[model samples]
Target: MLSFPSRKHSSLRVALTALTTLAVAGGAAAIPTTSTATPNAAPKSWDETAYRGQVEVVRTPEGPADTEYLTGRVFVDQDRDSASDRRERGLDGVVVSNGRDVVTTDRHGRYRLPAYDNMTVFITQPAGYQVPVDESNVAQFHYNHLPEGSPELRYGGIAPTGPLPDAVNFPLVRSQLTRAQEQHCVIAGDLQTYDRTEVEYARQGAINDLAGRRDYQGCGTLFIGDVVGDDLSLYPDVKDLTSLTNGPARFLPGNHDLDFDSATAEHAFDTFRAQMAPAYYSYDVGDVHIVALNTVRYPCTPDVDNADGRRPECDDPENSPRYNGRLDENQLAWLEQDLAAVDDDKLVVVAGHIPLLTFADEGSAIHQVDQVREVYELLEGREAVSVAGHTHSIENMRTGDLVQGWQDLFGVEGLPFPHITAGAISGDWYSGELTENGYPVAVGRDGGRPGLLTLDIRGDSFRERYTVTGESDRVQTQLGINSPTYRDWYAERQAWNDNPEGAAPELGDPHVVIREDLAGQTWLTTNFWMGSTGSTVEVEIDGRRAGEATRTQEMRGEDQLIGPEWSDPHAVAQQLVHGGSVADRTMHLWRFELPADLGTGRHRAEVTATDAHGREYTDVLHFRVVDQP
Candidate 1:
């Protein structure tokens, strides 16, 4: 059995020291320490002294006046209060928006935009200046305006704001933490908690991990989507999870976080916007401009012709409404305006609930953005990285990576830049047996463990890393042997599952291979969770010279390699025996063929994996070979 370390908290000093030792010993470079000292210097610690509050909403005089426009001011919070004071001066040239029109603050730090009935007005948090955060460490930079309130719904939507305010001012504080060149930004995927029980499971797993770490307080944690399951009532409990985090918590709405009771596409996420964040928004930290897009279209109508023979469900909305991976026209228009304002030198981080394109659902028209080419054209010739979370799998697809499904569905050949499907926090919807930490194993369909993705950024360049929940950063890969016996058992299990039988025969000795099995063909498979095209895996048997292992899916204009032959044996074993999605078909799996002519006995293979970022990790596997059973 695999032995996991205890789930006890480690002091920051101890953790850093251990990490430094590992770095010196030729492991991945130690995570850059955080500090609140200088903009050019690397951070040393969390900015504990930073002011935390919300936006300042100015009340108007009692008189019938012009309500054609909404106004706001962006100012430095001198007294640490959330409100804007008389002496405090407004900061100029900051970008602000009213969900559609993009504008910038004048010399007086004031901005004006056309008024609307139901709109969300927010600021694109400028680099070197941190916005105020609420009690739960959620960044408070937006003002929701719904004069008439939401329509009748099961979960309470936005309450009535009565009338638009005279001024809705935003507060900011100077933060060296946000100004630092080096940043560790956390991108957490589906924390799709269905009930209070799942909330506790999250609390004990990834939540606990974030609470203990202080390195990401600057760029902070951006939960990329699916904050909760279908039940929007659990949003408060999810907020409780964020309260335990050391950084500012931001969110993007997912398909599951929708209000199914809504009658139209416009009000589908009213409740989510009321409780969480805007359906879509953008912010800046250092040189990175993060554009969080609302990519889920509810009650979606067919935007593209049926020539591709996809998304037939999108034909009707009133009687049979369904959500699809698409951006509305308004959002698209706003995206164009948003990108126009950003400087070409800045790195653009395009984040959304549904991916612009993904390897997991590359073939599904409903699971990928409908207007993907438009987005690519808009971001053409600029440093960009796309991150999304809908498919509960981890995919680190780099630039030029191609798949047949993308070409067939979207008429796209290869990726323009890196695109990552950050694995789900509620791994496979929290399926499988519980671990010692009181959470489900819930291994992903791609054999990736439940985890969070961290983008360690320096200037316009970044390196991605995945930290499995309740495990150390070193646990990057899962090793197993795929022999003839396991293959036979996989077929047997699939057939038995199709037709219920008295009992299913369990495959014995998964780590053992007989002479005949070796002759038939056996492979040592490595499931490198975050491995990408540039990553490499090598195996050394009995201290012999190491030979490079071949990646199963080369991702060079090829279709998905699926089914039992390409499955992860270790993950499949748990999934079939206990519960969870089967581990089959992944872009990151690598295999090394075992020699057919080998002496029968115990054998040990030392495997080493070097990631795209050149971070090295090592694992060992021991298996036995015999002449007979």
Candidate 2:
């Protein structure tokens, strides 16, 4: 039997010990040293211990006589071994797939699917049970069968599998953790590590935080694309990072993860399928159903009139090939079939690499999915939410939220369900200055911090929250003052950037505002990372109640609001001085106009931001009303 250590006291010793000391000193009843909670406990944390095993591939004296079809069994492995024993019982009615066709196990947990070349056979993990994981904590449920390996490429693709086996058996163990109604699903985006240094940076930042937490184990962590930055060789090191996590790690294919050297789109993600996971798949946990999709169409041809403009680069595929955000016909057909098999009562979570629609690149057709309307029609009248990661920005777009580009290009007037663009793990390509924690302070293009999104699911509903890397949940919003003086300084800085000058002039003080500047127009801006249509922001100046702030980019069929007036000053100050993507536009920035007739003195502004779920986060900003610069 394989034994794994518990993570209960691994990272929370200091904090837990402090709480224990307080209880003992107060003379109250002592807290239990170990967990003694029941299976029905309201709040249950994962213990970080799981049965480490692999799939059992049974072989006979000779291979199976039948070569037309592949067969597999889903059984309960009571002995903790990968092989199935006589006493081990087969689990019936479990879902299995051969990339396109979905099937269920028979009475004896045996399933037969059509066999084909380059087909990936996998099973959708049923609720209340968990498939065995490898040493790296990666869910080992799929079998990649490529009779003939990938074509000649720069990166070594999948090695050819000789022939069909007798029987491929899948082992699963009972887990009460997944059966629980409350679950935390981690949606991480764009861990696009280009080299070894960025991998280490990821280790210190999000990976370190995940190592300390034990909340997400049942639902596991899903890395939605961009696993590596166009370098397929780093897949092993990336898997090593997942080994430190407390849950089963899964991945999706992104543009950067493509085999660019491949001659066709059929083999573009062959290496990814061998190392990570299938191009697209679906699974169930609790009352939620997650569908992972491969939305990147590589080496796209100009024959398809999907994009708004022509891509001259894709004219000659033999020479140059470009990737566009569009799903192929087969995957789209499979998606409809996959959803038809799912129960209507379950919450459908559609996850992909590129977003179906995004506020970051709202005007660019290639950046957003081409057949978005078709996807929406398929999920009509069903409880669904879309989560993606490719824009490297955090966007929490609610239902009925509309953008002009969506209307112009896809004819989408309002969103049918919530669409969240979980910010990138490698924020701004790991640009900007390095922090003391050994990781770069890689603020995103939307002026949002690099973080992971957690969908706290309870029954058929869910609440979303974003946790900044290496920071507590309380750190939700960034506060800054946008004034006329700052706008002038912004223009001066931009012009100086175009032409080389002796020394760049800095905005004397962003927090200080003159009377004339206030007379023109001054507003206190709040960059709430997860704020959406239903969210509200209120400001109070020096204990005086100010009016509620207005969101700059109201997703009401309007064009994108750009320029310094709408920019996040707090993020711009850092990006302009150091180096990174500018935060000139976003969908989550709120502004409250300051009183133009204020006195010349230092003042305090307290901002309280409330999300759609009624969760509130408060932050304070201090600025001076100056007479002159």
Candidate 3:
């Protein structure tokens, strides 16, 4: 495990002027004859002053002719038409452009630039005009195009782009801070907008949420990544969506935040750093140290002779991908140094795009590292909790031998720390038709509502709430077994629906429910999605607190396909895909004898679950404690 000696780093400087110089050609392109037309045609010498918003453009792999540019005009909605009327003037000096080729709006608030196809174009948002933040703290802004038809990409979803409109306009309303808006936040997952239309889809799916809100008080928002699918150019339009927001917006990088342009670690995240911030960094907010870590790696080439002896692949960039985890010497050192400076007792919340521990393909090369255990060990006994996204599923594995079941794949074992897979706010790639809010009603693997997690950290203890779409403070504790016996039944059902000829085996007695025959010795392990290490599961018998369960194990390992050697056709079918089952029937979880004194007619007892984030959930079980005949 790496460690940093404690020390204080300088406080981060607050941003002053929002406007940054507009980026011009790196290597000049011939001034377009259309732009250079009549004497009165073009504004004199790039007027630099009348402009008020932002514009970003990128040079694609193609030569200059094929290059694309996205220009935008941000207007003040004096009459609230949503569109800029002739009399309405555009905002001036607004910062615009993709992160790299930035430019400011002129005195006319009109800005234009050369960008590439599928590139993002947006504004930096002047102080007066608030930007939007998605549920994951991503900002709302403009992208250059949304092609009408689908483009060729692995994840197809962006809306199509029509003829370049006269101007991609952004409108801002006067700001007010309403209570609900005061603490408002927007969450988005791998907007992964591969093309212009997808960028537009992202725009449509997210912009409506920003209309006329005030509560955020401009605290801003944070977007956990997989931002523009894999296309880094779309970041600008991603920025534009934030312009509609009522607060400041921030971002954290995910695996997708890479520069395919570069081939080594040095340039691996260079594109991301150029577009966002240092991969892993932190900020302070009301007694909390929010530390974000960059855990992804750009696989490198093999090293000669496996020189370092640290690991044969550490030296070989080519071998890194097979490992799928990273934190370089610099980052590891910086992390220790970063943690060293914080007051030991200050509440620290670490955020990353990939989870430290997860149930999805645990043994797969894509999971977090064995070294992560050391990172967790460093935070031992500290008032800390780690949060992450990227799995695209909602899972709260609070405890149970982090590496116990799945470590062998990575050659690791043991509980490292408390981690939470915050689940994607976009929910299965925003799966559905677009909503008026400019987003889709994307839900997750478990059919839970699409939402985000909000943490109200009060000292060492924090309260977290998962706000679902169209639902308030909804939390799901039980995944509710998909049923082992119905494994083949569900398979058949799915197959039949897909293709009758290829139908799976007949559905057995799929309706029979199985209850725990906890003859006082059975243990139940519940994964309250997003549960962290310090969280607790309490049992109540007959409305009385039976005992508080200790979180002693971690759930990180490869799947063990063998069950109770379940060969019975009906039984095996039910347990097949549920992923939940009885284990050992004796260890870790506990089943205790019901107190004989509990004279039972109809007894109702509740199970209370409290997470490290302070979110509580209660479920009641009804039964009768009657005398045996």
Highest TM-score against the true fold, candidate: 1
lDDT of 3 by residue, 126-184 (tens): 43344433332343455534445233322333445454444566665443321111122
Candidate 3 off by > 4 Å = 1-189, 195-219, 302-323, 377-381, 399-401, 405-417, 431-449, 475-485, 493-629
- Please provide TM-scores, in order, for all candidate models, with all chains considered together: 0.92, 0.91, 0.53
Q: What is the lDDT of residue 412 in candidate 2?
A: 94
Query: Candidate 1, residue 277: CA error in Å?
Result: 0.3
Q: Is 1 or 3 the stronger prediction by lDDT? A: 1
Task: Give one digit per residue, the lDDT tens place, for model 1 in 1-629.
Answer: 11112322222211222211211101122121221111232244444544688888877576225588887789998888888887988987677778887777777788777779989999999989999887788889898999899998789889988888878899899888788767778999999999999999999999998887877888999998889998999988988999898788999999988888898888899999999899999998887889999989886776542335598878777688888888888889888878877777677899998999988887898899989999999999788999999999999999999999999988998999999999989988899999999999998899889999988777667778788898777778888888888888888887776786889868887887878988776998999888999999999988888999999999899999998779888888777777778888999999999988778999988888888766678888888999997
TM-score pick, better of 1 and 3? 1
By lDDT, is 2 or 3 better?
A: 2
Decreasing lDDT order of the candidates? 1, 2, 3
Error of 1 at 526 (Å): 0.5
Cα RMSD to native, each candidate?
Answer: 9.3, 10.4, 15.4
Error of 3 at 170 (Å): 28
